[model samples]
Target chain A: MKKLNYGIIIILGIISFIPLLWVFITSFSPGNQVIKGGFPFWVSNPTLENYVKAWETAPFIQYYFNTFVIVFGVLIVQLITITLAAYAFARLNFKGKHVLFILFLLQLMIQPEILLFPNYQVISQLGLVNTKLAVMMPYWASAFGVFLMRQTFKQVPYDLDEASRIDGCKWYQTLWHVYIPSAKPTYIAFALVSVSHHWSNFMWPLIITDSVDSRPLTVGLALFAQSYETGAQWGMVAAGTVMVIMPLVIAFFIFQKQFVSSFMHSGIK
Target chain B: MAAKRKKFGSSSRHNLFAYGLLFPSFIFLTLFTFYPTLKSFQLSFYSGPMTRLQFSGMDQYKEVFSDEIFRKVILNNILFMIGTVPTSLFLAMYLAIWLNKKMAGSSLLRTSFFYPTIIPLIAVANIWLFIYTPQYGLLDNFLHLFGRGDTSWLGNPNTVMIAMIFMIIWKDTGFYMIFYLAGLQNLPRDVYEAAEIEGAKPFQMFRHITFPLLMPTTLFVMIVAITNSFKNVDHLYIMTKGGPDNASNLLLYHIYEAAFTNWDLGKAAVLTVVLIVIMLSITAFNYLYLDRKIHY
Candidate 1:
């Protein structure tokens, strides 16, 4: 029975790897021979031509630049807002704090998709449509980030805050010097989560950005794939897809343990 | 007397600082999130394009109830949630358990399972679109090995939702597995040993011990899964566009089409309100029923 269970697991693991393997092979297949399949395993005469073509066909470099701008912009703003909000919720004694915090939590409960039309209207009103800032604006203050950071902050001892206060440090100063420094792991965890999420974010960016000047990788790839009317040229699509994902993939691989643990920490509670 | 006055002033100043710290987030939320939500509700009562707005009272809601496409889209969304959530959850838990054991190359297996999670949904949809192709796609060719003929996985109206469901489950189960794995890791080792000493069989242990302990994680996973099933529209938008006769159209995608494609802003706003109410009430219900039961 144990042997059978292990066997099933091994089979499942191999099955999980197949789609990625297929993509890798199809990416390298020479020419438009992507569909000539006798098990996509053996790519006879693989070439780098598809990669070059994929690169030249689109403004991928611009897409990358736009995506980085949006991702980092959102992350920087979110780190400040969430940290401060979390600090207040965790340590402050302001009036109606609990009620206000609960109201903030309601954002987490509501689906972001439901807000798309209205958010679009707001962006249009701001004259931020077709811009990277439009993509970055709605995500500036994340409720989930606040909640996660608040939880992390609560775990730190009160003595540290008291000591800082005794030293005549103001609230913001204490937050910067003590609370933020102590929550490094939480910050890293949130950073990874935020970066990956915004990197893969599609629908909002697609809605907000009109042209290649502001389009991110996902939108760029989608438009690129759709432009191929005769179905996706598997090699080019795969190559393009790989380029879109490789940065996050490499980051995950390098920080596999941190990534997994962060996911676990954020998810389980 | 001097000390008392200083304390009062300092305390008031500190209160101001606390509010100051919270001011930016509240302002952003009010402008971007809360205001839009309220405007969505308000806009539901009007029916016109960008400039020509007219009040229609509850006419929009009435139309939503009577519209055949709206009914179909709601049914399709529910069907998708029903199909994907349980399958993904169960498979994730089962695989997570297997991977949690002391096994060689477990990290590699975990990474492979998780690779799909990191890939952008648009890209995944592109890859899966090829896979669902009738002749050269991996799925059809693999089925051919079992003496089956070519199948139009995405093109057939009868199979479109199911095909999308299958791809969704495949993409998400590994991601869910990470949560289950974390839950499993957090379980106390001694409890399992105690169950074993009490002569509990594997199934018995799972039923009486493991499942009970994992309930919180299960609940979290369920809520997240359902919410994701509702939010995920990119695949449908890219691959099917809720097509093959709108057989695969879910509520969110329907909302997108209504607002953007058809330019029926009022109807789209109505749909958005209904979607929000449904989602919020469901989440509220889940919280009311399951929140307190969450052990952690």
Candidate 2:
């Protein structure tokens, strides 16, 4: 049983990582090797030429900067709004709070793709077209983040709230001191999820930004490969693809336990 | 659990504080989600651009329902869901069960299974694009072993949706596996031990014990998968773009072309309403069945 299970695990692992591994190897293999379908499985003559060419061909350094700005930019704003709203829904006793919370949760039901036209209209109306902020605007308020944080805050003991009040801590002070300190795990979980999400978020960014200055890595890489700029050079395409996803991949590797456990925490909750 | 009331007349001030805390999110949600959703619904009935609008009740929707391409898109979406969700769910469940066991190298296996979760979908599509390339593509090369290597996976109408579904399942299964993994780990061990002591077969044990316990997670994952079937169209933009006489055109991608490519907001709005209605009905189904059990 153990050996069979192990065999299944090995096969599954290979299948799961094949695309990533294939892309990585194809990036290092010669362009002709890729065209002849010989490089993905093995790279006998590995080279960095594709990476160099892909970098030279596209302003990937600029794209990396723009992508980070969009990812972290969205992350920071989302943390604030969701934090405040989560705090409100979790702790505050207010009239119509249930209705508001339900309304908030309703956002989760609406696929953002359905809102593409209306959102584009709104973004352009606000004169945010061709801007990085435009790409991040609609997602500035994340229902999932709010839901996660509200659940986290609800688990905090009311004693802390009372004690903070007794210590003359204002609402904001209590939030920063008592609540935030205790919910560190939740915050880390939310941050990791949010960063991963925004880093890889492609569609909205694809719609909103037209130029390299505002295009995130996903958009940049997509355009590089699909828009006929590179014209089906798999090696360069693979290299650009690797460049786009390397940050998240590295982050996951470094925080493997945290990433898995955080996912478990979020899913179970 | 009630604390001492500070001042009875401070109700308004307390309300003020609460609303003040909630202000930013309220504005953002209203602008992005609530308002757009309402406006999308309302605009579904109207015609033309924002500057020159006409009230044509149900006309847009009528056209949407009757259009051949729209029908194809809906059918494609249903087939896409049918193709991707159940297979990925079962695959995820199998992997989750395997990973939950305290076997050697299980942690590595778990991480590898979730490799898809971290990568971007667009990037995945690009990688798969190369793999799906005709003649000399990786898949074609593999198919050569079986002596049938010339299939244009993405080009042909018949295999296009299946090809798209394959990529989606490959990418989406990991996320669902994580959810199932959580559900599996949370199950009580005593019942399983008792079942084992009672001489239950592994398959029978799964059928009688594990599967029932996993119903809630199954329902939740199903909802996630259904919603993702709509949201996940970046691959179409790269891989198919709903091509070969609209064989693989899903609703969202069709709407994208209508609004952006064809520059028809009215039709897009109508399509958006259709999408929202389908999603809402799914939610309504969940509310009626799963939501009650979810909390309890």
Point to the candidate with the largest TM-score: 1
True contacts kept of each: 0.64, 0.77
Model 1, range A1-269, lDDT digits (tens) per residue?
A: 87898788778778878877787788888755765567667887898887899999999999999999999999999999998888888888877787898889778866455678889999999999999989988888888899999998998899998999999998778888888898999899899888988999988888889998899999999998887735347788878888888898788889988888777677745
User: Model 2, residue B288: what's the lDDT?
Assistant: 92
Tens digits of per-residue lDDT for model 1, B95-116? 8988888778877888888878
Candidate 2 chain A: minimum summed lDDT over ten consecutive residues — where? Answer: A226-235
DockQ of candidate 1 (2 decimals)? 0.69
Highest DockQ scorer: 2
Candidate 1 has an lDDT of 0.85
TM-score, one value per model: 0.97, 0.96
Cα lDDT for residue A211, candidate 1:
94
> Model 2 clash pairs?
none
Q: What's model 2's lDDT at B250?
A: 91
lDDT value, candidate 2, whole model: 0.85
RMSD of each: 1.7, 2.6
